[model samples]
Target: VLEEIGIIFRDDAEALALWKEAGADVKGERVHFPKGLCRSLLKTAPSIYTQHARNPDRSVQIGGNATVFAPVYGPPFVRDLDGNRRYATIEDFQNFVKLAYMAPSIHHSGGTVCEPVDVPVNKRHLDMIYAHIRYSDKPFMGSVTAPERAEDTVAMAKLVFGDDFVENNTVLTSLINANSPMVFDETMLGALKVYSRHNQACIVTPFILAGAMSPVTVAGTLTQVLAEVLAGASFTQLIRPGAPVLFGTFASSISMQSGAPTFGTPEPSLVSYGAAQLARRLGLPFRTGGSLCASKIPDAQAAYESANTLNSTILAGTNFVLHSAGWLEGGLASCYEKFMMDIDQLGMQQKFCEGVDLSENGQAMDAIRQVGPGSHYLGCDHTQANFQTAFYRSNIADNNSYEQWLAEGEKTAPQRANELARRWLESYEAPHLDPAIDEALKEFIAKKKGSMPDAFT
Candidate 1:
């Protein structure tokens, strides 16, 4: 279908020509790839790549059986402790950044965790990048809203990692979504051009919400996703061969009755599994699946749906998991309670991914012998040595008996999560940065903001 019907490369003659010169059949704005061409171009892509963080210990390896978790992206509203859903402000964004930094399981400080609507559209990217740089030492994403914003991200990154280091290393990875049903918009393509030229990484994802952006059937959606990502990845390689990139899919289904987008469904899981297999075949890092749900709040529906998606992501062997936490109401709101709940669940998922240990120590034969067949092993030497680290413990879950629970406030999981969120913010301390570099970053942002009039859109 990609060759026969072709895909649209909207308003990007350079990309269209690049595809044509690289063996794709160009018909006006649409470029059709010949059989095996995409696979051949993808052969140069690295199976795994390192994304460096300011704190060297925090750097992450993407692909090759590794799974990295990042928080939610592109939500505009936030649900606070008082259960009020309102437009997210800079303060809300900073708070989310602090929470993400405090969470040990979350490895990447994701871009646009919630859009700061109060900030001017043109300048919010600066604040977002600053938050990630100052508040956390983890690897982060760059802006893709515009080509200029992407350049700004690179400039800001230069201050953090030095210009020479930024040019030589992959310090930032960004999301470059394809307009579904075989279209690549100018804004996204422009951002892709900037990032790929700078040797920064891009996640070429097809934002497919089934029965809307794509066909209702899993097979049909999967085919479209593959074709879309192939084209985007091919474009990245065209800009700079060997530039780091990820084959990404953000597929979800829609409700038949309400026309509402549904997540954590069976179809998305199937697509995620198939997408991972395809990505591995193409020799590129894969990114997909998350703690996705359509729940309005952090309730039973949210927990069940989030668990389903999280498990599917691990089983699919996803490399970089975006929207790993704090997604609610079809990506409209970021909930504090859900963020904490997802972090706790992330700890469990990490344990699950560790698999089983068959070593002699893991067998615990000595402990069994010491306890004997009929005796308890609770006080055995092995148990005593390993009890503290043997199993995964949730920081927010209640373990008290019914009487003890009643004696204390009868707090639910959400309530506990809310308390933990508050504590994280209260205890957060910004990571230190070199004084000269910090001043340079501030100067850069101020200069850029001064040059442009406030753009609210």
Candidate 2:
């Protein structure tokens, strides 16, 4: 299909040719991969890799049996207290960063949790990176809006980790989305080139809203996803050998009735599973799935949809899960309550991933023998010893008696989540950064902003 109808690549023709020359068959503007070419090129890609955080303890191992969770990406509006949905501001962005930092389940402070509409489009990435640097100790994604912004991200990292450290280490991992049905735009390519050249990691994702950007069938969608990611990942290798890259898939089926995109659907989950299999076959870390929902609010619909998607993500063996929280209305809005609810759900998923321990202690043969025949274990020695760590407890869930719940005003899950979000924000403290490095980052941002006129587009 790629050879016959060829993917549209809206970028430098010379660079395109270079990619084609590197084992891909070229016909005019289109490049096709021979049957075994993709697999051959992907052999050099690592099956697993480590993403380093500024705090060594916060570093994460991606791929293999490990999974890393990152928060929502590219939501333009934010829903907050007073139940208002408004254009996200810099303040809102910072608050989300704080929430991500506070939530132990979120491993990476994701890129563009919500567009900071108050900040100029050209300069917002600086503020966003600064927020991640100052507010969170976890690994975070770099800006991919432009190559220059990606360079700014690297420069900021240098200020934080020192010049020598960033030169030899992978400090920032970024998202580079392919225009689905096989097109890669210049902006994304530019950012990918920058990250690859600088030794930073990039998740080469195909942004496929099936039936819109791709074919309606799951098999066709997976084929397109595979082809796109293979081409993108190959291009990264051409840029710089041994560049850390992930094979990423961002796909959702469209609602035929309303001409809208739907998330957390069965079809997308299947596609994600196939995508993970393909990524593993290619010997690259895979990125897919999240706490996705189409609900406008954090209600029953949101809970069920998000749970379905989250469970599919864990089972699919996705290495890096983006948009793992705060997604609502099919990624158009970032709901605060939904963010907290997703974190609570992520905690549960983490426990599930721990799997059943087969150790003697885990078997608890003695405890069972002592209890025997449905006799109470609540008062047994084992129960008393392990009570604190025995069961997974939710911070935001209400598990009280009906009368106790009534006494506490009978707040719903969303209400309780909202309260928890507020408390987290109230108790948030900025993580420490070196005084000189902080000042250097501020100066660099100020100088860069001053160099360019504010451009909203």
Candidate 3:
């Protein structure tokens, strides 16, 4: 339906021309980016604001790392918003998101989830993301993986939390049931059921990589995406349809040249757009953005790729735009610089989305009449009173003269971002968990571990 509407992965010559017109540096499947691509693309994005409140504190939030999203500098095992306690770090350029929040992502090593949480806390640079309840602008989503094997899921669970966390959090096995495909074993089914019983908010996904897991063409990718969504939804519905599950649409467009995962290439972006449409069809939220692949530091490439994918997806309205912060290398390694830059990018989005208020009489228009068009709105009363309320800010946004910028130290966005992250870390104090309850929770995990000594090994 979305395709018929002419607003999804457009890969034909015509589409290529369109992307190029949007300032994309297209080379076949690759999309080289130009500055301001995201801001520009968002103008065409097909989503509408869901809601708003008059109160400043009222907000909508979405998508995060269950572990790596945590604050690293806080006291060990700080409880996050989702009720999971874990680590957070700032010293490393790569941050550990909160536990289980980010769909299981591939590490640069092609092994290990994003965090090293299972390892001792002191040595691990783990991070946990805490989320207070809120709505989010990103409405489409794509979950990362849908492994059928029981052992793989059990292993995955252990890596995030200990053996006990599974029972305590009720994050059932990611594996499928015994009556189902052998690919999905009984253990996985049991675990998923357990998670469902608790009504966990998760996006189940059976990942299909083109030229690797599925076919290389768009049709093959679509078929695989459909199958994954079917499997995920089927399982969720049976387990608990009201579990706030989203359709899985995160697919990687593999590099035919290096067989490496491509980032911000038209291939992956296309795949993401495709996934978004499908999820919309299911009327389910999709989780599909964590795309930051340029190796360049807070340079042009990073901005271009991140902004293009972000603006495109936002325009497309993927339910849970993730990796909103701290990501790099095709969404493999988390980069603080990239995360910082993306925050600025989001701020810019906020600026763009400040819906126009066409109130007639006394104010905006009256002020306009008072100033008479181009005489300069900069020095007017209406302008001074509301300029700060109307502008987005960025250190790297090129808003000042070179000489004035030099006078202000000409700092890059990353510098300001790093300082911000550091400041946040320093000023932050972990939310207090009931000490005795926390201890008992730890003891419960220990006892569960004791029940199966062999499970640890």
Candidate 4:
């Protein structure tokens, strides 16, 4: 089956050279991940430690799509008319994941906010989106940017919101600090001042764009990405032995002709590949968002790009995938229709990768006997048993005739998605918090003076 298909690997000479210049560990095809990260990963085992954040994990595989999903879904606003928007419960997330990653980037300063999902089409909203995210049972994946400066770290840390600003100081202290190379010495001190606060699973990520930041080749990018991961590991090790963290790399590239960074380009694909390798070397969870290719809708472009990224990263073993839905144009904006389409696609790939079994004693002979040498197996029980499980079966992805599709109103993916979101909201119920616990949580949030989402009502 592997021989049935072909793959191409473009060699970027410039990117490779710069990474070597940075004193990265390089081999012919794979780079020896940083030593610091490997040590930490061994200590942490199942957690993300980062000999090289992108390497595939040895014990178990993990992957990511670093999300900017916290922002609003409908008509955008820094703050809504009613103040805060409320989402029913983390049921949607909790049911789907064993753990979910959350990170607030300095990028959020530019109006990148914790946007709420107004599914109930509600009357009230929640004020801070991150707080609701914090209320979840899943762990937080906070990130810090250390670009040689501490102040830069401080600003990034400030994004984590708590009921009261004072109580949440640990939000910044644990996750944000002098933990990454992204923070040039220009702001290291300011970052550490806050780092002394707590101990949570916070990750330091690298946004190494292939030509823009690192050199422009896959090999070079791999080594360069390794060094960046090393820098992050240095911070974690200095703080404690087994610091819970993940390796992050968003190494996109610039379209030589367009002059704009092409996250949807082959560069991002290469980065995904390299990050996975790095994760394996470290024996820890790795990070890099995937499944975003189209500029507008969930068309063919999105499908191919997302599949390529997932294929590479899953092999690499990244932890906590993000940007799982609603993205367009390198994540600049999101389309609801495309998001649902992508979800369907995700289900399909998962089925395809199930891989065929060659082992004996399973019924290969029986299956053949059932159908006979020249007979069709279309109506066989074997076919019926496994048929429905193939790929993501869906109402939106009807393979029915044009007449049948039209009978369903020929509704596009977006329409289907809107209805699905509506259905999810209607079916969702608020999580049951102990009455006293609920009061405490409410009291905590009540002190914060700001807008509250009308949906909460």
Best by lDDT: 1
What would the TM-scores of all predictions be? 0.98, 0.97, 0.61, 0.61
Cα lDDT for residue 357, candidate 4: 60
> How do the residues 1-457 of candidate 4 rate in per-residue lDDT, one tens digit apiece?
0011111111433323433444445443223334343354345433422211111221122223222222212222111112232332323323222111111110111111223343221211222223333333222232222322223222322332323542232232122222222332323322322342333334445566567666678787776566655544434444444445556676667777876755456667767876776765665556666565535455677666766655554454445445544445566444444545555554554445456766652355666778997888788777776676633566456588999889989976556765654454446443333455445445434543233343332
User: Per-residue lDDT of 1-457 in model 2, one digit per residue for the tens?
Assistant: 6555556668568667775677667766667766766566666666777888888999999889999999999999988866899899999999999999998889888889999999999999999999998999999999999889999999899888877878677889999999887888889989998998888899999999999998999999998898899888977878877778999999898889887988778999999999999888788999999999889988898989999899999999999999999999899988899999999899999998999988887899999999999689989988898899878999988889999999999999888888888888898888888889889989999999999999999
How far out, in Å, is residue 369 in model 2?
3.2
Off by over 4 Å in 2: 23-28
lDDT tens per residue, model 1, 145-249: 999999999999988888898877899999999999899999999999999998899999999999999998989999899999988898888888888999999
**Span of ten consecutive residues with least summed lDDT in model 2:** 2-11
At residue 347, candidate 1 shows an lDDT of 92
Pairs of residues at least 3 apart in sequence or in different chains that clash in candidate 1: none
Candidate that beats the other on TM-score, 1 or 2, i.e. the better one:
1
Error of 1 at 418 (Å): 0.6
Candidate 1's TM-score reads 0.98
Model 3 Cα lDDT, one tens digit per residue, 1-457: 1111111211335434555665556665333445444333323212211111112122123222111111111122222222233443332312232211221121111112244344433222111111110111111111112322222333333443356644343332121212111122333334454445444444445455567766788776776665545443444544454544545455556778888765566666777778778766555656665535544355677777777666766666655544554455554445544554565566566455545665653248757777995697788778877777666656435577999879988887666666655554455443333455345444544554455333212
Candidate 3: stretches off by over 4 Å: 1-113, 117-191, 294-296, 360-363, 395-398, 407-410, 432-457
